[model samples]
Target chain A: MKSRNLPLNKRGFNFEMIMWIFTRLSALAMYTLLLIGFIGALLMGAREQMNFADVMRWAFMPNPSHVINTNIPDIAPWTALFWQLVASALLLVATAHGVHGLVVIADDYIVTSNGRKIVRLISMLMMASTSLIGLYILWTF
Target chain B: MGITRNVGLMTALRYKGQGPMLTFVLHRLGGMGMAVFIAIHMLSSFLGGKGGQFVNAIYEHWSFQLVIFFFVLFHAINGLRITIIDLLPKLLEYQREAIWVEWLVFIPVYGFAVFVIVSTALGSGG
Candidate 1:
């Protein structure tokens, strides 16, 4: 397998191999989604008069009389809708691909059988929670 | 033989590996970075509607975002190269060439992204 560096579980290549394959297959799709989403964000940031840096900024400063609204106007509703769709797809694919990658990494460092299982379980849980949150974020818009 | 042991960060930090090994190492590191970024991204999205201040503060800092962006940029480009090599085993013969191609793509893409971000930051007068 191309993922020769990845450590397979004691059970061998069955499920782990599937995930390794999944990552490979998902790469092109994820790359496209991320690229579009990123470019969309850049354009949207411009429309909103916000820079990429503003998206990273946190809500720490005291609020002035007026609130800081981050939503962009419906300058291009269809484009906005399309990107939301892209984001929704990205949320699912990226989470599954990323969490499995983390599991492969964990398998490398975590020696004991039980320890590996624990790490895998935590990873799955994190994946599920984040997927739900991501979907929720998409649903709101 | 016993199960593999964690080699600790000191050994891991050494860049003594070859080309393929370095790509593998960076891919793993980038994967982990993505995991962390995804977690925070989800959390921030959930809270973003309720409040904007915190998210603004985090995004306002160009330097921090640049680091994160670099990870995503490098990982995506290198990953495409790996996927291509994996799917088309014939390309394996040109592994050295493939690595060169990956770097060529990465450097220009990353450099352009940094240029845009820096320009945006400076333009905003932040």
Candidate 2:
């Protein structure tokens, strides 16, 4: 007699696939983002607009409340902060997705009691690192 | 039925595979490519240790432009492709199309870089 094939539900891998899908998305976005950067680097208008003295002259320009304004660049520090916020928010979502995938992949192979514990410990460490960095970017942005 | 193979003990197991696993494989490969480049960049920065004269020279090197541009172009284009894959899995078949688009975008951008470099070189005697 021939055997039957199992359905997806019946043989489900049951992997809670948490893909830090953002890393891939952001990675890809970041990949080609510099095409326009060639234009940015060539832009000497900023260089032309403000001589070092003039740049220093504008040192007392109005800054937003959040900026600690320690040793940041002269011209719009808040503009830099805006982009940083956007980036770190995406990172938060991405890290969560990554954590999910890591947990699932770990669950798949770790069989022994000690092995499972170690895997969990390592995953948690990596995840905590991702979170801390993400938060730092956000808070300091 | 058109989409159906009869489901019984006699039926063979089927994978409802929507994409060529090759796409999945290549995605990781491309990610790794970007990562290795980034690692080298960070290492160089670390080795250079703050802004010394050597570090400044490396930053300004035209040779590094190739590294910077190629990595940036691929990273963004391949990333956009992966984004589409995640958001719209059905369009995964056209993964190659995305790479082609990347190349398409790369051409003019690279051309302009050449233009800039050439102009800067010839114009440098002043």
Candidate 3:
């Protein structure tokens, strides 16, 4: 079998390569944040105060508004700065990761470079606006 | 680059790639499903009123939960498998075995989640 090396540019860092790395790293980051939220909820007495649904919601996004309607005794702990930051991080990372996935999937159907560029721009705008709205709610509510 | 060709649905379905191909299709679907879910969820949270609650009510249904949970669990596990294989190209030869292991892990976890969701809905008379 003849061993052939991939072109240097193909192997090197580029926009697509960077986004690929971002996708993997962002997945890890999401898992970490989810774990932190889950543990934090448990520490805050989620086992007794919340149902499975509520706990899952908090784990997915630790915003205080998510648990306010639940049986949790006090929303004070959840309304803290740390939880807000964690929720904001989750929102940004998840939105970016998902938007990139959309663009990659779109690339499968979109053949032209101009079409790809349009899809990428739309994806970026969607990611930015979604993150901003989510962050605003996370902080305000 | 080669010219892109469109295959008819029936023709596409006739081609068999077995486990790897099934996983590939499912992974893409799961990712897309979760992406849509996340978008709806964010918008609902942002809406934060009767409008938001209405959207929340839809997803809060047990059936929706079941589907969303399946997407999340499958995507996470399959993604981890892909990442591990990417990091260790030596595992490339064992990809089939890895898919088997992935199913072994996925089925039980997803089964338990479904069981819980169903029981909860029943308990609530939903």
Candidate 4:
């Protein structure tokens, strides 16, 4: 009897391997964002460095406090556009990949594609909403 | 769950060895460890005004050697695991033994963290 061997493919030979890569990459990206953000916070000093209020000084203003209705605190704009923006963007990318990786785990467990689809939808929605919230928070700072 | 089992078809395949499952599991546990710390980081970021008290609390309790020891171990082990899976593909063969060794090290690490947290918490007049 003869046996067949599989051929190699790039973009990873299988989904699990791909998910593995995604987790590692996402972790690394998160680590980078964290380190940068921490460094930024420490450099700014006591009251002025952190807090939604300090960052809000630069990130948001409604022209008047009473207008739009919601009591959103003004967040400060980041001191530097370069690393901070890069870090925030990287976080978004990591969040996207993280959701995708988790979806793969879900797909591995859920037998039905319909269930998988629903899960993916919910996952994406939550991720998108969080991403937006994070962005809004960053922007307000 | 069934989809995950028997699907050992690891890509970038090199060598295979029967290794202790504990080490591999511990490596994953590192992820949970980092996650706990990350949660603290986020929450602490929001704790903005209490910089001094916050720093003091951390130092007076979870910031000591035992805690740091476990934290560093988990981070190092997980980081090692990530490096192995992502970068050094050849190491998967001996991964079992490597993982077990990690667990052996983890024994002391865990002991230290537990001791630190307990002692510190107790010392805090809790």
lDDT of 4 at B21: 42
Better of 1 and 3 by DockQ: 3
lDDT of each: 0.68, 0.47, 0.86, 0.51
In the range B22-119, model 2's lDDT, one tens digit per residue, is 44444445444543443343344334555543654563455554455444444445556667776777766676676677568767766666555455
Between candidates 1 and 2, the one scoring higher on TM-score is 1
Candidate closest to the true structure, highest TM-score: 3
How many clashes would you count in candidate 4? 10
The regions of model 1 sitting more than 4 angstroms off are A1-13, A35-73, A76-81, B5-15, B48-52
Q: B1-126 in candidate 3: lDDT tens per residue?
A: 234788888989998989999999999999999988888887887776999889999987989989998898889889888877776677888999999999999999788878877987898799
DockQ of every candidate: 0.40, 0.11, 0.49, 0.07
What tens-digit string does per-residue lDDT give for candidate 1 at B9-118?
Answer: 79877857788888887887877887786587558756876455476467447786688777877788788998998888767889988988888988886777678678
lDDT of 3: 0.86
Going through the candidates in order, state the TM-score of chain A alone for each one.
Answer: 0.63, 0.41, 0.90, 0.54
User: Which number leads on lDDT?
Assistant: 3
Select the stronger candidate by DockQ from 1 and 4.
1
lDDT of 1 at A111: 72
lDDT of 2 by residue, A1-141 (tens): 233478857755353322344455544443333222223322523354432222221221111222232233443544455445444554454445445445555555566677777877877786677666445534552
